[model samples]
Target chain A: MKLSKEEIAHLAKLARLDLPEEKLEKITKDFGSILEYVGRIQKVDIQGIEPFTMPAKSEGWRPDEAFEVDEATRELILANFPERAGDLLAAPGVFETPKK
Target chain B: MKPLNEITIAEARKLLDEGVATSKELTQACLTQIQSLDGALHAFLEVYADDALAAADQSDQRRTDGNVLSKLDGIPVAIKDNMLLQGKACTAGSKILQGHIAAYNSTAVRKLMEAGAVILGRTNMDEFAMGSSTEHSAYGPTKHPRDPERVPGGSSGGSAVAVAANMCLGALGSDTGGSIRQPASMCGIFGLKPTYGRVSRYGLMAMASSLDQIGPMTKCVEDAAIILDTIQGQDPSDQTTSDTEPFRISKLESRSSNDLKGLKIGLPKQAWQAGGIESRVLENTKAALAELEKAGAEMVEIDLPYADEALAVYYILMPCEVSANLARFDGMRYGLRKQGLPLFETYAQSRAEGFGDEVMRRILLGTFALSSGYIDAYYVCAKKVQALIRQAYERAFNEVDLIVTPTCPATAFRLGEKLNDPLAMYLEDVFTVSVNVAGVPAISMPCQEDGGMPVGLQLIGKWFDEATVLSAAKVLESELAKQ
Candidate 1:
């Protein structure tokens, strides 16, 4: 599995990681070996089998409201954050701003 | 003042019933042990000393009122940081949510509290439960209590180490691809991953949801059974939970070694072929089998036709689910949020800065695997292989009552040995990952030592057959104790 630098960068972008240029070679090689090891899954014959997405269960079951986080606990949770700005946490924007 | 550190939950429960030890005393003893030893072990991400003592005191009062909750009432237990405990930091050992406190109690944690177990603290884990070693934790790696230089296997490393070091009587840990069992194996304790859906996952932070199941890590198999009994059964909150009859673990004692007289144990030939398995590990595993044979269990050589593909399938399926599950942590709803930037940049930069290297790698791999063009090439095909692996286990179980293997390839490695090499680290989970794929129950128990480090033997059973698995583990545990 030969991973090009562009492929690595694309993966980094998808993962939202900031990998500097110097680390690219190392990351590429390591990921290559991992993918090589992971390549073995392709050998198994699994035709026509349904993929299990969640724990098996019957249809149409609703969960009971057993435990709820109380207001005091919610307040404590909100207060614990170091970067809150008026009920909203501020972070670097990942989307384009709306037109003014 | 009795030494609380040395007392088991069973012993403490007996004393509490007999009016010999107060829950406050027991909780204080654990707090003292944490204060004294946890600095070096780094087992706890946050300690709830005051809250724990209060809970313990309430249990004491309940006992005084002749309304005992359960046998484990008043005994303190630590929770893995990944499992939610209302009002406790639930970091999942990542910097992204370093200060995040859970808004609700996970069903397992709620059950433990209902049974009068005090929440001692939150134990560390790999970031998003992604790594084979605890070194991936943002806070730091948890050291093996047996030897500080060696890693306590992860992503449930802290829970295993705390139990091994007697910082807590028992702890709850989630196993997804050997998070519980590997660490239990490395730390010389008992850890069990119950059949998938046997325990509810209502509020557990997701990490490969299909493979994750909450279980117990304790000093002994009996304790593990007791904790399992408390947490197992139907929870409406988690529809995946079964309505299976509650297990009577105390019945295990009456089941003799002769109870296993005709039980067939399968030794998968492919397990031995996995690379990096040390000579001593194989030797100890064989010795454990010999002991099992001496106790009347028959050993059979079995072939898992597709067993070799479990790791690859796991990497694919896990990352795909992780990429989807982790999308909720977009610096919104809850968790660490970087300020002063526009929304889009904030999401990307926060994730980039928040996640560790290994976590980033998985996210990348997972994102790619799930992408439109690659879904069939990777994710869909991996699921097919996963089904094949599960079918292989089903076929093997028809001939053998249980399958046995080395819990890990080697004893505990040095702290930083495999941290930098993700492939080498992922290989450490080779023996344990298939059980997760099969959604079967498995137990990892200390069989012997490689040098001064502990080696673990894994016993895997059919789905929902934790009773047989634990029973067999108890037999092996007693045999090891005798030797």
Candidate 2:
């Protein structure tokens, strides 16, 4: 499929990538061929073939259990967050407080 | 003093145990090698001279106290930057993650440290482990240790080069498609991507989480086994990890003779005619098969009719996973955050400035694949093909114990030879992708060289049958050593 700049831009938007204008043509061309290369799978007769959704049988693992966190590493984790107040992380605000 | 860096992990362990050497000395030897060659090879993203020495001294003290954790204790080991080493910079070779530090230890690094292994430093990799060559690294491409003009097969190229050039005794690398094996082959060493669930993926920067595995790249196969033995086990941190015992090397190395009297090896006929495989590679691969046959192994021609679709399936699935996995890098939390008027603009600006071109390409491709209209057509089709490919391997394994192929279709090409040709680069993983897709184990060991450049022969084995696979690789390695 010949992907137009608009389609490529739409994908970039969905993927949260801000592609530069100059690089748009090349990515458009690349996605075209990469899709073409992967498109070969459409020809393989996959009748009754189940999609391999998991890498391994999940039955072998232990049941969901909470484990103790390494305290020192927890300190490091809090430190790496760009904006944190006390133990809370800071990001763009989602909703404004309603007038009471 | 014999060069400490040149010794294999097994040999180093012996010396350290006998009080013949100290980890500090070995660490110094590796540091010296990096000091001399790293400018040219670009193998290490960082060299932990001080930290390694400190760890080595601790290892020496432990040995003095009659406590050696495992065979790798006190040995210098390098790691691919993709694996989180607490307090170390792990960019995954991407600009977007430049300032990101690993807050916790990846299970492999954690285990390696528990065994008293001194981490030399984090090595380079392809950005997000996407590209075939190390050129995709945000820093720069790593040159092949043998030939500076050529690429060291990548995204584990830095780790493989470190081992090949004696910069480190061994290195930990993650293989999604062929990252570990291809580079190991190009660097002329032994590398293993154990059965998919053999090692824990917790803290490993996931490329294709279902396929990614951490394994060892070593100077010899024994060292690979030793390292894997120390690192492989169930980790509650990673639920996908298999509840398997640690892989032991002694049984594999205990073979009294380099013989394969009753071993059945399969040669996938489709691989013999794979497009883009160089004539030189075919010759080397055929010659190695003859050597295996000479050692009493029976060569059986096998048909993997779906083998040709492996690359397509891998490209589709891996990128789809990459798209999802990389979504966490949004500017909110860490590394290269750019503030814009609105949140959407901030994400766009930060990601634009942070990711390299190839990474962007994959994320976009993945986005396209997993998007609304194309999901079934691309992603679903690919997964079904993956299933078919797995079934094909299962059928082949029923007849043969092992399958053999060239690690890559060609030896390390010139640095820029296929960089622009994305499809050409993707073809590099043709011989190795099916193993990951099928979730089986495979290894690449050094074979004959083509025009003095190294060639690697790959050994594919059934799931969780690493012992048999290593035994077969050992016999074949002995055959190559004979030459």
Candidate 3:
């Protein structure tokens, strides 16, 4: 499938990447070749074959038991926040407020 | 005697046990090598001099008190930056995770620590393990150990360089589409990618969960076996890890038969094609095969009809997983953050600034592939084709005990040679990706040197059969060394 500039931009939006305009053309061209190369998979006659995501035999299943991590481990995880408030990780507000 | 750093793990173990060399001396030798060459090679992102030496001394103390943990006790090794080491910085070579400290040890690293293996440092890699060349690493590309001008193939390039240059005796590298094996081939070292689910992925920064498997890069096959034995096992945290049988090192010890008595090696018709492959690579691989044949192994010509499509399937599936796996880097928890007024913009801006060009391209490619109208054509089709490829390998294995091919089509290219061409970079993994796609174990070892560069011969083993793969690799390793 041919990916247009608009298509690439839409893809960037979907992927949460704000790509620069100058690199757009090059990326579009690069994607064209890559897509063309990867497009070969479309020719495979997968009439009855189920899509295999991963092997069925290698599954490691465990009981659904929840346990609290050690205090030291808990502290280590909390300490990695780029923007933090005491113990919670901070982030931009997700919702817009209604007009008053 | 050889430089202490250049000694193999087996040699170092002997010295340590015989009271000839102390662990401190070996660790110091590695640190000295890193200090001397890593500035030019860029192999290690950070060298843990104090920690490594301290660990070494502790191991020595244990040995003195008759409490050595395992055969790996006091051994110095490196870990690819993607694997966490508890409190150490784990960027996975991406600027996104800069200043990020791992809260807990990765299962592999934890195992290494438990075995008393001294961790030298975290080596550099492709950012988010996206690129074939380590050039995509945010820090800088690691230079080839032998030639500074060429690449040491990647995304495990730095680990390969570290092992190749003797900065570390062995290293842990994660392979998602040949990240470990290709670099090992390029650097002229032994690299193994254990069968999928053979190793736990508890703390490895996920690039493609289904395809990623952590393995060892080392000076010898025995060392690869040692590291794999220590690291491979089912872990409670990783549901994908299976309770596979151990990679019994004892099986590799008995080398009574000089000939591969009943071993059947398959040469796939697609891989042996001369057009895409370099002349020297073809020659060396053919020569290596001839040696195996002379040693009485049956050489069977096998057909893998879907072999050519493995790369296509990998590119599609890998990015789809990458886009999902890397979504956690939204500037909220831990990593580089760029503030924008709206929340959506914040996520976009932070990622856009944090990731490199290739990463962004893959993310977008993944988004497009899995996006509305195109999902059936790209994602589903690739997955179905992946099944076909897997079946082809399964059928081939019925006829042959193992499959063999050149690890890479060509020696490591000059830096920037294929850097600008994304498709060209992907082609370097053409031979190696199929093993990952099939989820089988494979090893790449130095077969011959093309001019000054080392050419790798790869052996593909059946599912959960790393023993045969390593055994074949050992035979090839010794056979090639004869020349």
Candidate 4:
């Protein structure tokens, strides 16, 4: 698969990374090699097999109560953050929130 | 008094039973060892000196009171930093959660505690268990005890090093891909990756949920079995854990024999393929097999039809799962947070600054694989290959009782040898990845020396059949001892 520098940058953006321009060239080359290495998996003939995500019968083994983080624990967790104001964490605004 | 650092858990338990040594003295000896060696090895991320001593005292009290917890009661065991121990910082070797203490204990940790194992400390690991070397840890790389300039094999490198250096009697490590075995091989210790779901993954910081399994890193197979016996069981917290019959270590140990008679060992045709592998590694592996044959095990050639593609499939599946599992580490919840501007920017800035290069690479690759247009093409294809890999193991098992291969392609390389080349680093796990992908149990045992470095023999077994693997390892251990 041919991936351009712009596409790599877009992927980086989606993944929330800030790759420097110099590193981008190396990353591009590395990704090309990795993709090339994994290219062989595309040829395996698994047409009739259902795509396995979770193990078989995994759904039946789900816990009775959904594991939940309680408010106090959540508050304690958030309190350890280096940058939080009130009940919310603070960050630099990049993309604006979309209107409902 | 014999030094506690030199004694294995089996020996220590015998001492404790015969009144030769008290748990308190044994625990104190381990603490001293950690004090002496940990400064250089950095094997431990945090040492619970006070708590460990106190636990040892409690176990002694239990003995006097006639209410001992179990055989492992008061035995000091180190835990990988990724496993949760309530009130201890479970950093997962990442700076983002450096100060964040776990709210709960992992099932494995909880079980160990219940069995009276003293929590010695949390060991170092690759940041979020992402690297082949512990160099990716925010704190620093754990140096191998044998050669300080070289890496201690990683992600679980710290645990292996601790066991190898005698800083801990036994340690816990999670293997997603060869994390435990690779480091154990390099460090010359026994490491096991239990069958997927054999041990619960309740509170282990998820790297690749489907692939991650908690297991033991110990000085020998018996200690590995003892630790495994305590930790392996069903847990309500982790649904993937099986409710199959509980694994009994005593039964496994008793069933083990030095005689490999009637055991058919299969050697994957791909394992001996030409190129890149050092000739010394091939020679040492062949010698180990020859010794096994002398012990009466039959060797058979079997094809792991999909073995060649395991590394590729592993990279795809691991990164994809890791990306999803690690998405929870956003700054808003519990980890590092960068202040300023807006919330979205906070997450972006925090993760961008917090994560190391290897982690960032995986997140990017995983995100790409799971992206809308590429899911079916990459992620789906990898999972299919995973099934094929598992089927290959099933087919091999029908032909032979066990499979043997080189634990790693080569012995421990110098620290910087593969640091620049990610693909080269990935290939280091070539022989070990298939066992993990197939969800079969495997153990890495030091077989011979290659250029002053340890070469490991990997014994792979059918799913959930760790006894067969450990028994074979015990036979090899005895053989190596003779040499």
Candidate 5:
């Protein structure tokens, strides 16, 4: 249940959250209490019980058919992008540019 | 005629059918009430006044043409901001999606629209439905109509308040954990969390996907039944939706007429007492059980031994899902996008700025729980405990047709009281979470008043068996009304 600041930062990294240095102290303290609460799971009797996501069917498999989105709707979704070109969204480059 | 805003959906239908009242009059009355009271209540994030009036007028036109959609036709309703209304802002009460508009109608909202229910507006909620109190809303907290100093328990606080204060006759609310039921309890109205997969989640913003359900918050059990009838069914948009026969309000009434004879309601020995429930709340719950017994229902003492651990299981499993579901808010396509030269920085910075404190805390908790080193101890263990809890309920249902418990351990608490401590706030849902965890339908209805504040009695039924739950609640509701 003891969550050190280092662990909090590591979690922030994994979560893709830009946590500042100051937020770490409070978050770590929170993690301690929250972890303490859920720590009861460790004591739960699970000798033969399976790890279940839901009591009923949690998800369903849909056919991989091409569902259609009209042009107007597609335009609206593209419009929400931070960097937009004509009918397209610009995602930041995943690979570095080659040096000439 | 009675004040337009005071009429229930059934009453409005009767009056409108008799040409005694117009949908415009009812819709206008609600708008006037909102104009007058919403400044103090903060229940609505945005009100669709003009659009609602137009819809109401259209309903009037259709009715004049001798055509009607359903009982909900021409009635004004509110929607939790989390449920999408296409072209309306679906904030989920967070800055993360400050200007994000819903591209298409959520299945529930679309159903309501098709039913000719004039959606008044989007009500406030906890940011991404994270907190127990509406105080976590980035927009602002929704005040209790009964006591301005107290919170209208949330994240469906606005919808509850909307119905309580007559801003809308009924509203749709989504429950993940106890969001809908607890708020309904606080507001002294009827709220139902249908069995998971009973209602489609096509457009309702995801909280904990496995545990979440869209349901109705209304002034009466019958209205809850009517709304549920309209919105519950299979949909191609959501695969989890079942072909369970849609719940029938008439069947519920007919069942209630059987007068509760031989009906068994159970009280779990291991639920709702561990943290010392308030004396008044416990007394009200016991009194309600006795009242049901007086009306010919058999009340039995039962045990959901694993329910004592439901909270721990919920906190673990829910956040793990949250960590995964909320990971989509990375400033890439929609919602709050911040710029850093690289894509990674944009995601982190956007989320860091967009999410509120409670949301961040949960995301962190979820991330930590799902982390490789901690997964077995936290997430996996919680899931096993969840299965155990479900099994306990299954066994209990085999013995009893329904279960009864306090909707909340206490009435509505003051707004700022538990904000400082996260765990204290999470405990507000102790009584209601297990029902969601079990994937069963449960409802909260006002059983009594404690010092002028409402105490809610929760009726839980077998998975997908909302009829028994509503019927049993109707028996208790009429009993309370008679008194």
Candidate 6:
């Protein structure tokens, strides 16, 4: 196998995904074959070839200006928050405090 | 008249202009079809019956005032769940964004409205447009319109089936790899994937950002042309949309020739191998090409050496982009959230419960490819190979005006056929991915039938040159229909 189960687990963590324990073995096998297939790229000699990421030529940058959000649009954005307190969007706290 | 729902956009426009049919009648006819067929087909995630009828009435009023917006005015059409329609749900077939309503219109949606097209509703799709089959949709799998046991090719499966079964006159589907064309081919309709920057991407859920494009799925090539004419233009909201020449339906309409007298269509040597293409699909595709040849188009066999590496390049680059685009789905924002202690745990737990297997698999694969220590071996290598593939197509385009291939190696498979084997599912994209890689336009038209299911013939054209592609497809479409 090209990728071990531990590697797949590590990937899931880095991707911020919480994979269930039962699905790990199957995912590892599936991911391994996909990697094996995509490994064919290594066989091609791309020594001098430049990587082509996008087709559109850069049209220069748009002006970095912020515009005012209409009230309806602002309310709509705030309304979508999963947990909100009035105008403030809420989330679980990071960096837990040690016992005093 | 043959049930108003079964009529094509061209025929409907004629009827509406002659005052023989009202927009409300057309909308109701489509709603009736959705009511009867959608339950079994699972083609629609939501149906805007009342809103559509209301829009239709407004269209009828415009006609009374002699102020029609364009040919598409009052025509009923569906949008893939991935495209936003303001104030309505836009789930993108994923539970992660399940109750999420779009605040503003997708640029395509806005253009369609501006043209007075009645918005029918949102069709289902593979979750976040990840899988080739709509079976990956968190809601449920969309069945093939003809054979309920088989899959309508996806992630635009629902939109394909909608247009195929007449749930709506036409629909919009986004193609990343083969999302739109594969499903359109399977369902026996016209699916167009315009050049990467030809259509604006604003408000559409991003899959592989560089490869994603929203195009039309319709009953005829002209209908595809008409829809493309309406939605093809640069948008201030989307920076990627190019200011290239607009798609002109008049150009498509002006072509009166039934024969492809001067058109040089290239048959890629790499696409026609014994093991690569199924015997039945090859036989059908060749037969269709023979008809085009008989009509006077020259068929040249051209070499595309790097075509074989397209799927690999697509898988790597796509996942990398997918991983980055989907990172926005943290539980802190819109959609579903599963509470947990500490910020990180909440994000992980929410995603675990929200995304389906295929989505998580892609995310994990993408994360691994882009992760440190492996980036060069996978990500950079794939991109370099992608450059080779693009260059090869550019060289071929100099020799041939278009390229022809079987949309898929085989007909639509049973629902669970390739569900478990991820690589097998990825193989379904073999012939279609290269088009996206080269950033060219392509269309899939039904060529023949294999075991009762429709087989599609793909016509590819130069970048930003959809006019030539659609005209050639129109000739072939008319000739094939005569049989």
Question: Which has the greatest lDDT?
Answer: 6
lDDT per residue for candidate 5 within B1-483, as digits (tens), equals 668897788888899999998899999999999999999999999999999999999999999999988899999999999988877788999999998888788999999999999999999999999887899999999999989999999999999999999998899999999999999998889999999999999998999989899999998888999999999999878778887777877788687453889898898877645567888788888888888999899888898886658888889888988999999998888888875447677778889999998898888889988888889898888888888888898899999999888999988899899998898999888889988878899999997654578888899999889999999888888888777
In candidate 6, residue B220 scores what lDDT?
93
CAPRI-style quality class for the chain A–B interface of candidate 1: acceptable
lDDT, candidates in the order shown: 0.85, 0.88, 0.90, 0.85, 0.88, 0.91
Better of 5 and 6 by DockQ: 6
User: Distance from true position, residue B205, model 1, in Å?
Assistant: 0.8
What is the per-residue lDDT of model 4 for residues B309-346, given as tens digits with 9 covering 90 to 100? 88889999999988888888787667887655366666
Candidate 2's displacement at residue A68, Å, is 5.2
Model 5 agreement with the true structure over A1-100: per-residue lDDT tens digits: 7989998998998898888888988888877887887797788779988887533443547567987888877766776677787777777676643232
- The DockQ score of candidate 2 comes to 0.47
Model 6: per-residue Cα lDDT over A1-100, one tens digit each: 2888888888888887888878888899898789899888889999899998564545778789998877887877888899898899887777873232
**Over the stretch B1-483, how does candidate 2's per-residue lDDT look in tens digits?**
558899899899889988899988999999999999999999999888899999999999999999888888899999999999888889999988887778888998999999899999999999989888999999999999878999998889999999999999999998999999999988898999999889999999988898899999998878889988988988878888887665777779676557898899999989876677888778887888999999889999999877768889899898989999998888787877775336786778888889998888888888988989999999999988888888899999999999999999888899999899888899889999989999999999987754478888899999898998898888877787788
Which residue segments of model 4 deviate by more than 4 Å?
A: A57-100, B448-451
Off by over 4 Å in 6: A55-58, A97-100, B274-276, B449-451
What pairs collide in candidate 3? none
Model 3 / residue A94 / CA error / Å:
2.0
TM-score of 5: 0.97
Please give the distance, in angstroms, between residue A67's alpha carbon in candidate 3 and its true position after superposition: 2.8
Instruction: Compute the lDDT of residue B124 as modeled in candidate 1.
Output: 91
C-alpha lDDT (0 to 100) for residue A79 of candidate 1: 72
What are the chain A TM-scores for all the models, listed individually?
0.67, 0.74, 0.79, 0.64, 0.80, 0.83
Question: Which digits, one per residue and each the tens of the lDDT, describe model 6 over residues B1-483?
Answer: 799999999999999999999999999999999999999999999999989999999999999999999999999999999998888889999999988888888999999999999999999999999988899999999999999999999999999999999989999999999999999989999999999999999999999999999999999998999999999998888888898888887777677658789899999889876276777677788899999998889999999887668899999999999999999998887988876556777778888889899999999888988999899989999999988988898899999999998899888999999999999999999999999988899999998554468889999999998999999999888888787
- Candidate 4's C-alpha lDDT? 0.85
Error of 3 at A39 (Å): 0.7
